[model samples]
Target: MTEKNKTTNNGTSRRDFLKSASMAAAGFMIVPRHVLGGRGFIAPSDMLNVAGIGAGGKGQSDIAAFAKSGKANIAYLCDVDDRRAAASRASFPKAKYIKDWRDLLEKEHKNFDAVSVSTPDHNHAIIAYHAMQLGKHVYVQKPLTHDIWEARLLTEAAKKFKVVTQMGNQGASNDGTRLMAEWYDADLIGDVHTVYCWTNRPVWPQGIQWPTNKSEVPKELDWDLWQGTAPRKEYVDKLVPFNWRGWWDYGTGALGDMGCHLVEAPFRVLGIQYVKDVQASVGSVYVDEFKKGVFPESCPPSSHITLTFPKTNKTKGDVTLHWMDGGIQPERPDELGPSEPWGGEEGNGTLFIGTKGKMFASTYSDAATLLPKERTKDAKAPQKYKRVPGGANGHYAQWVEACIAGYGKMEVSSPFEVAGPLTEALLMANLAVRGHDLKGGALKYTWDNKAMKVTNFDAVNKYVKREYPAGFELKA
Candidate 1:
């Protein structure tokens, strides 16, 4: 457990709030462009002035990468929760802290050259969208957004804004992921078919849960602001700090948590254009007392959902991809081979079965290898595709370099071009869950990438884009 420990790189532990305040007070005066970062001088032109819109867990991780470059000026830190905002200010004393992202956009839009949107899945589009419109380069974290429409809008908006863009699946640029794809392209295994990817999360339900806000609202939390794009609800303590990932209103269930990292490799190397058709079934097998108060009736306490994507005729033949989550697994994943157990307590890692052999990988798309053991060494595959490059300066560093360089080159493996579609497809899984849950029926739809809309299923179609809270429009 990486509980917050109060210590700096120099090993001086923060003994009291007083000591923290005193030390930070001195830090607040220094120009972050120079003093806070301890690296050799970089040309002012090379420094990327960056503002972070969400500075909780992942948000701070992105900031750390930028701070590491010693070439970043953390011009501003923004969070909807006052507690988060205060903690971030204490964490990066050099950064100016703000409450509402809109205030930063309206007043300090030009203060930073690039902005990192690390909010939850639902808000990703709003923050990143508005930032790009202000002409700032943007990086929004993965499961790009909470819904399919948001994903499409983001991809198109980035192109329209012409800003350097990256999704927070940092593994996209890692050496391991590159090797994973290269191995498949090498035909170390024959044509791949069927993928079994799973994660153990969303211990809660999707959609909304209600009356759970009975717990006192923390003085530091701005419940209304935290509900930025989500439907407003009373304050609930358990939902804050953590446990927000399982709710549909704020998150995209299991797919949102692990999809970008797990589903990406198979989609990329295979060059899958679209799922063509998708379906999901969600059911609750646990809970006795009213699971209300924390979550709305629309959500289940725990759910097992399966997603299937039928290969289009354009895909040449049929390729069925299966997703398992909520701590469930196939009876015998071993038929695939010796494997690692996942899904928290009970889930299987991703499986890819090919006509000639099989391959399995952990969540990050690293640890990828062939099946049937001997087929790996004897395999013959074309060696023509140019080798992809490994990530150099961490996630934020790459984006920062692009911001300063004025043009960001594609990293290939997990660039927005690939991550965007994968994210949209996965988000659709959330809609499928809602469809199945509401009517005990399946969701059927057609996707037009050009138009970015579902041809049928209006109920789920309404889900493509959710209503944002007032004044949070993401405009181009």
Candidate 2:
């Protein structure tokens, strides 16, 4: 038995303490707050104990947000690299530090109420799936999974396990998304038929050959553990601390990195689900005067992909979403003044084109505005949905509260049910981007959502479900 389930000197286990605390008001007289502890004290049982996996970079901020919620206690921290995990370990000095996530989950599952997965895109699904199987609530970072099959599996797992799940696309809980939905519902933009979501990502290296020389593994890092689900590879510099997004082996390119944030607005506003078909055009890289670089392992420096979704209850016809990365963007709408920012002050944004008008929002779906710029001034829509307490910042707390309330009690903004479809849509777009690199791959690829395959291109179908290394295989 685990330490948490062991009997205490008073003949009560921690489980028993929790059960009794839950039954306190029903089974016995309630004591006043002042008599119990003090004016603003919270019982230990009321707190959600969270175990953090990948405790560095985005992982660090994710757990810090949960702790900021005041109802969540950072119970454990796990990371493969000590250097990357230094700050988080210092911040949560009391949290049990573990080097391997598998060890933490296998040995300490009973100690925490939930798990936060902030690892690379390739490992997101496996970690989250395992945690869900163990009956733990999970909050995973964006692009939920590297492949479409994994997203679908996790979506079904959440339903089967009946656990509260949330994706780390905090923008789903932002007021801008809700406001955009309100405008769409109000018919302010009529029926949206097209959306353009663009980003200036791949800020990392892309369209390049893999490093020919391997570097010595850093003493503070566990190279093997870091390559968890990926096939074994020699240690290389600049892949860690954030350049992985450019490689197919460990990252999902710009589409996977920023698609969740930019496309989420349209998904929430238009009620879009799985994609119907996709096609793409990508910029080429030439190695020399006569030779064109064909690096299959790396993502293209730039690409423009188009995804089509069948008509939903919210729309009159099919919807077309254009995804552009590496600084590509759509043509400027005539409705906007020359001085007005196309997608906000930033170069990245999502634009919705409806029969009546056009609307757009910047990254994180912030600064939502109607085209013609002036239309935004007179736009008014009835508040139809309840706003999250702190908007985008409330995302972490929202999951914490819902987990404490138990599954199906409270709602989270980016639950797996919704995130699954959104993520699959982006991954589908990636199929087209990757296909662009193959022979006769530039043509449109028809998608069979039910089968989760590309009906037109057999070569691209292999990417729908990636093969894992031994001991890391994902079971259906």
Candidate 3:
């Protein structure tokens, strides 16, 4: 057999198939599928080969979801911690395993058509950006990047590379969000001027000091790789696996963890883009009778941030969005009965206040409802948009199929184009949260979207674009 058509023990080689497929698309002679295989057989070229980075926790589930599509091959797996990667390694035994993502991309880029990045918030932008530069499609976890600048960079890169891109906010594809959009379109709720998104998060510890006691790195973990873009620091106990969500160096606090999922509903329904200004009030922890504990390295225990957005084609005037976390919630709307749930059964949800009526939805934008409880019974709106086959769960397959179909060939629910601004808005809210402490008082920060900085307070602008360690610097 010719080298290009060489087969592995089972069948055609993925790398060779990809090469041949590219040539065919470039005007080379096409081979008939039946001639190459039986009538009912599917070609290897039809399947998307995916390389998974951060192959544990959310990463593990993401890989499995893509595999569940039955149209993806988990061709490679890379993780900083072997212990964490164990399950995925056992699940996809054929996928080559590596300790560092940089090495995997360097040595095996030819074998995969896409990359799934579920790494910590700090590392998301760098890994995904590099993969896109190599002309591979990317699926990144939500709160797209750690900083506003990074989010904008990835968005531009997606278009520049002409590669399929998706952010891991599965709710963007859920039926509830689409229904809300349809309802708004039908004027079931008139122009929504105000929105409230709340969640009980920081389930991980926050508003505390970083542990000073250094701990030996686990044998199964690569400490350096885990700290990818963040400043170098000693390894601390219990920081890995989950608790990183509470730290500023590694996580975006509660807003980063849940903002994408909760705020997405109003962002879509109102067609809002970047925020024009943001103000925040944070709950402080008292160390004793005289002093409040100051843990600048950690996120506050609670915060209520307000972001105002300029008017869009869908609204008559500017929109105001309220984001509350750390167990804070908006006042219960009087339209509902006293015993009725406030946000949703879970206490995490989004509420929309409009001129004519109101609407709300649970976390992930699921189970949408109208106000007054009774209004929901007969609410009607035309389903103007197409729904994914399996709703939110279908997010993975949607990206996989879109990658196989090539960029611009298919539509994904949360492409970088839509996700970028959404993420920036959340990060903008965070800027205010952090600024509240930096200013030592409550203050509103005006945003210059074009300049990508805080126009009023220059101190908070430092976070608009963060400084990275030498090796991890993000370059244009």
Candidate 3 C-alpha lDDT tens digits along 181-267 = 998999987889999999998799999998999998898987877887887888999999899998999999999999999998888
Model 2 score (lDDT) = 0.86
Model 3 segments more than 4 A misplaced: 1-45
lDDT of 1 at 278: 65
In order of TM-score, best first, we have 3, 2, 1
State the TM-score for model 1: 0.80
lDDT of 1: 0.64
RMSD of 1: 9.8
What is the C-alpha local distance difference test score of each model?
A: 0.64, 0.86, 0.86
Q: What's the distance in Å from true for residue 341, model 3?
A: 1.7
- Point out the worst 10-residue segment of candidate 1 by lDDT: 1-10
Q: For model 2, give the 10-residue run with minimal summed lDDT.
A: 17-26
